[model samples]
Target: MSTFDDLDAFVATRRQAGLALSPDGARLVTTVAELAPDGTKPVTSLWEVDPTGEAPARRLTRSAAGESAAAFAPDGDLLFTSRRPDPTVEAGDDEPAALWVLPRHGGEARQILAPGDGITSFEVARDAGHVVVTTTVPVGPAPEPPEGTQDTDEAPDAAAALRAARKKAGVSARLHDRFPVRFWDHDLGPGRPQIRVHDQLAADRLTEPVAVVDPAGPTERVRESAISPDGTRLAVAVDVRDPGGASGATGDRGDPAAVRVRLELRPTGGGETEVVADEAGADHEMPVVTPDGRWLLWIREEHAAPGRAPAQSLQARELAGGGTRTVVEAGRWAIRSVTGAADPDVVLVVADEQGHAPVFRVSVADGSVTRLTASGAYGDVVASPEGGAVYAMRATMDAPPVPVRLDPHTADQEPAVLRGATEIDDVPGTLTEVHATAEDGTPLRAWLALPAGASERSPAPLLLWVHGGPYMSWNAWSWRWCPWLMVAQGYAVLLPDPRLSTGYGRGFTDPATGAWGGLPYTDLMTVTDAALERPDLDASRTAAMGGSFGGYMANWIAGHTDRFDAIVTHASIWHLDGFVGTTDGSYHWVRQWGDPITDRDRYDEHSPHRFAAAITTPMLVIHGDKDYRVPIGEGLRLWYDLQRHGVESQFLYFPDENHWVLKPGDAKLWYRTVFAFLAHHVLGEKWERPALV
Candidate 1:
């Protein structure tokens, strides 16, 4: 078949796989994001399809810049995060990101907050009277040292200088400028944002707004805060650096240099503080309180789990007794978030195991784990108040994500497909489950998507799509739509749940311990080799791609091997040496790399940038300008190094994007660039290259 025909066929295959049902299980939301006339951009939108076997879906949110995080408010109103127009603010500031409230049936959306600044998250309070939002507020300036103090002066002078500096800097005096003060409260009205009842700190108190909980040292400011369901207590996730460490050089891994997480609780009316849990070396995140306010559920990672690695287990603690218990023991795969179900006794957990995230239910009393859904990987599960049904997005290796519903009690766990992806047409393809033996002979599970109309004798080009969480797993369902787009282009996609991936238990994911590059890389290579042995995959035209930790792997693979024709690394860490000093999570990186100061050689050897000269394949580096996780500077460093070494390289930088592109239009553009790059290098297609320099 001609390349264009192959592309068309691939798109058709993806179309079939892109079908997704909506949260309520009554409508379908298609994957509509596709490359616009500008081959480097995609078209993303929210479409509604009737699941009652009716006509095609109707488009819901149609905009050049798409919408995300759509949910039904307590009163059945639709609340979604969008970057629509905000005439109140002038252009050139951050894009207007506000929570838009609309009717479930659909209509014009009213912007709740005047757009212009960044609104990281919003939740409709149980009463629906107010909306809880977490946002970034600018701090004025750094504090000056005490008037009479000098660096070489007496001890009293030094203390005075520090206090003066702290006073002038406000709460964020010591942190990097990018680390702004994060304020959380209720949206009392259209124009006013008030601090929540539980979050109010008495004025003039020495405690500041909130406490920082990083491992390296204390954050001069508060980073994140969440409220309990009863609205009586607030759980604040603080990132405090260790104060006893060396100042300039990267902190040691075991030395407790990174931000250590602590769970602190205070009454809604403002009372004395209580420390619920604190691990000297580990970080606790995504804290959620039970409906009865009896237990607190959160994800915690032992400081021992290296950079960007998954947590050891999900833990729960009783507020009264102060005892902790393991809720879910799938190690290495991080639990993203947990929500109290309609039934107060059961809680729904959304976790990524081996890159494949799914929802599971656990009994608060007995601690029994029940698999609520089937093999398809899913995410962002919104449980009904009744606890009988769950709303989530499901995807597989070859399918675009479809909204689905899971009924936990019955055998009818198969997700009812809600809508088909509208952007790309689906091509015919066969999805298969395979297991490859790792270098240590451990079986690694993977999902393989092959081009349709292929036989044992016919092999198509392969695209190895790795997941970001080195701790996550590749599930059976459709969670990402990008892989389907490539599959539609006649490329066989292989998603492996490698060692250190969740779902396989702690032993498998523990490979990340003290060895970041060794076992995980071996597992990936083993899986790739096994896929090549399949009759339907073309071994000669293989490509590699991933984001975050996956991006790190892509860079690592590109530099370590020449087996793949092309590579794309998104929001990935390149230079471990630079990362030690630059990124916000440098201390965490050091811990993962086993104390870079003590293991400097190992850190340098594992870093992708260290071996940049060996990357001969055409590479595409994609990163968001404001990405704080794997900062954009890392990508730039790799892009410049590749160019300097006379390698074919291109960098696509999204100006208003973060670690992951959230805007619909930005997401579409990102996927378009990815496919176009892959098509050009992997399929030898005639595609235009956007100027990167």
Candidate 2:
């Protein structure tokens, strides 16, 4: 069987991410993740693809520790980061990742910038080759430098030594005087991110690093950044807390204040900082400086409120103190990333639009927008310095991400696929579109994947797979919530983009902002019913499954309807009131759902936990202990509620995993368990527990 037909093979399939274009646009490189020799974890390696699509793609760098964040310096040298041990120093397992450079003329890769704690990410200036890097530093004052050099700034290695001393003393405590003490899956404690500049970058070494944007409090950090083509100015998006706290009474929940991301422009060589964009209730990020250094491009998103979804648009400002203009109007689409185009007046903008994340060329001069690609989701875009071909990674439901070259001048043009590090020769199913109108006359659509042998005479069992983010779409390929795996097992998977999903304009997403179980839930059901009418699907033996927000809907559907034979929810919310207070981003959710204490109407009406007694369908609940976003408490409460109500159910728990089961072995088990559950309840097969449970 092929990879899609076997869970083991699927886990071993090589996955690719990150794309880098050489300065002259002669070479393209990306990092590919593959299972390690021990078969315990995945390691990444850099691979180079020919820009002209003439020669086959080949490996560029390899190491057990792996390499990532690849970028090309102006001198043609390739730069990357890896945790590989430095040959010149004695390495330990705790050694952090360091920056390395591969010579342009083809030679051995050398470690150039190996700070004590190591670098997190770095960007290379297009023209000057200067490097700007972000790294973590201890929150406390730096230990004093050796007495002789008191006049000079603290030694570069002082902070590293202090960190080591703390480790030696077994001090692993983190004290936070802010709202969010944690992030997605990890604690945001003892150290914060700091930006540093390196003016001298050599083939074999780098000059001393200078602190640029140092955070004064734990609440401050850089959101996004970009360096100008001339390497003289650095644009950064910084997150800072507002002096006034939340709009309503915070009630001593450790809530500091509302946070806003501001755009700032600072000189590279230590000078005054200029606040370019600082709106009161909005965030500005994803900075991209035009090739000629004439215009600065970034995304602005207003804060979301009850019944009012966050509106996003692209902003372009003249670097010479001229006024800023909205290049892409609000409610048009949710912009993802912006890249400088070959033409100085034009910039490439990628946004979700009608079930696809396509590239759009926006004229920075006139605020005009033109679609460039016809279909497929695109990301990591780069344009040739001489205004030639534009390169990006594109993916569709039927295919994984692959490098593609696009034309900057053409509108809705087909992208030319370039040879990538890995390829899938076959997919186990066929993909087609499913459309339906909501009860309110709003349009709804979905992508249906049918098994290879599905037909009217031999229909495939159905699985309605709702996407997460209630705010995101099922447009691109996702290795995590893949549908091909289900289709390979003789099932038709329905991938729906309901009202809450992006790409359909703000009108589609607005109604779902505060009313989670209202329009979005009904839209999902409407699309599923439309798909069930197909002759190639067996509607009677259907199951429903989803993760995150989709999981919340699965719970809602279980309480409201019993059309499906079984339901599977992963990393979901059970109670809106409890979820808002405990989630990492509590303030953000509070704005959307209202205060659970004072404004309790929405919580009482929409929370799925309140309807647990009404559910009759068999359920398989899944959650990870490390999932701070959804929290494992939701899963435990759901399991207990199911048992108390005498509902047939099973709990799949991951103590070491997060919101997503990312480990190879755990991900394989996740699929096996879900398939087994569906096979028994939906296919009328005897229940058989997964092995190694």
Candidate 3:
């Protein structure tokens, strides 16, 4: 075995994902996921990063169940939600997560509050320490009466208990009247989401809770809510059903079935609700109030029609009961992770641009933008109240998410690494950026990583890796699609950002959804042609790979061109019409592809299945049965097509996996089989059977 061929090393890699900062900015916290003691499940734990890059990183919480959703309380306390067993109280096997607090002064972390169900998300007021939490409560019919049983004082409680028992006994079934019967990966109905606002008088106690946005029943759910900076009001995003009334996410009978999200404001202490900001054909979400509570900022995503590109704008409103709307950042560069930096008039926005996701400072006064930290994809910026220090989690194609400190106002400054518990082993490759131009003369950019010692004399074979999302940019490190593994075996992988990719301004991306088959496919080939132009890349021995939307593109590329020696498509789509109906969220595709029957022309023209008979290159298809987004049927059909046509193809099936092959064993096999397939096709070597089937 090669020195880097051990699967254990791949499984042992610690993953760091999210970041948070203390109110004073003295401490930076990040969530790190690693294998548990038994190496069975990945446990998420909070790690304290030295914001100033001085102190050694420390693990803040350690428990068997793990902790997540870290947030800072007003009085310098750290609050997180956990399902860890509390020794002070009896716990059940199916324990609902409860709120726990770790005092800033340092002491034992203890449970502060518990919800009837469990807390999904929460926001805390900076001044009053008020908390707003969202939870779900399934609505069930009252238990059937016991054959004309008489009403008693405990009848309601008895029936509720019986309903719970029935659910536990697998007798409960759900019937939905809503259009969105299913969401991403799960069914949506049978329960309604509630946003509750309440004040925590002291540790381990609460005064009372007020239903800021109460629901009539299970259908009217509340979402995207935040506690005001002063704890005096609440801002939330609620679904505004289409006036046409008969549509939603079910995509039933080819109806529009679209719903838009709007912003609403109500008193935190429970009072009148007002429409804070609502734009027609737009959804307003991710509301955040300024530290002074003078301005409220949120994201407004304008729904795009077929043959058009969707747009996102940073919308703002005056919270002083006045009426004025402002576009802080207008649909440019895919602004993300928007937060009020140390300067209230400016916000720290992480945007995808070129080949990186950099932090940008956007001025609220003039709409001018300035780039902050130089190179890397930044996430969740946190700044000191004094406007002096800023910390962000930076990632790149080569490095995983790592906390770093940078000047908030610096136009270009190197980020000082804030040491954390998670770190990567030495990368065995060289990373560089390349550029290309599409058939329409539009420029494209991608990150290309080549193995060590790869050069003109010993050119490395290429792997054209298409990113999923067809909208998301390839700016950050992805464990699922890590090129280092392929590079470790002497291959160069190209990560390109096609037209539908973000980080570019609206002009480059907004129109991309409508032209996916045209520009996205063209731009990908353009980048591939550019990469092959390099002296160190082998053009004839290249291959293409992708998952999800990338898988769709791979399928398309297979039918359109045999430029690559082979292709590997995972969690892919084979039939557009079938995908629109069977996918967990059918409404999403209709927005971009239109109704299949009503708009059959577009589907027929763009769907890859129509041209599958033209595929000549060998292919490898990978899929998970539990993948609801791209159903297993897509993979099954593609496999059958390849076999029926007598094409040299292999199918790697995963029954217990999802959209992603997440298990340690499964992940290892994924890399092993992919490399083996590439070795046989790209290098003209004998196919090596993987350790597992």
lDDT of 3 by residue, 594-619 (tens): 66776778889888888888999999
* Best-fitting candidate, scored by lDDT: 2
**lDDT (CA) per prediction:** 0.62, 0.86, 0.80
- The true-structure Cα RMSD of candidate 3 reads 2.9
Show pairs that collide, candidate 3: 248-257, 309-510, 352-503
lDDT of 2 by residue, 1-693 (tens): 888888877878888888998888888999999999988789999999888887888999888999999999998999999999888878887769899999889988989987666788899888888898888777776666556765544554767767877887898888777768778899885777778878776456888764477754557788667988777889998988853434333466523556878899988777788999987668888888888888888888887877778889888888767788998888788888889988878988888988899999988778788899999999999999889889999999889998899988899999888888776657898999999999889988999999999999999999999889867899999888889999888999999998878899888988888888899888888998899898989988999999999899999999999999999999999988888888888888876777778778978889999999999999999999999999889999999999999999999999999999999999999999999999999999999999999
Cα deviation in Å at residue 594, candidate 3? 1.7
What's the ranking of the predictions by lDDT, best on top?
A: 2, 3, 1
Off by over 4 Å in 1: 1-119, 127-131, 141-230, 243-257, 292-294, 305-310, 317-322, 330-333, 353-356, 419-424, 476-481, 565-572, 609-628, 636-693
- The parts of candidate 2 lying over 4 Å away from their true place are 141-156, 216-218, 243-255
Candidate 1 C-alpha lDDT tens digits along 302-383? 6544433444567788755567787766353466567766676678876655435667787877877776765667765555
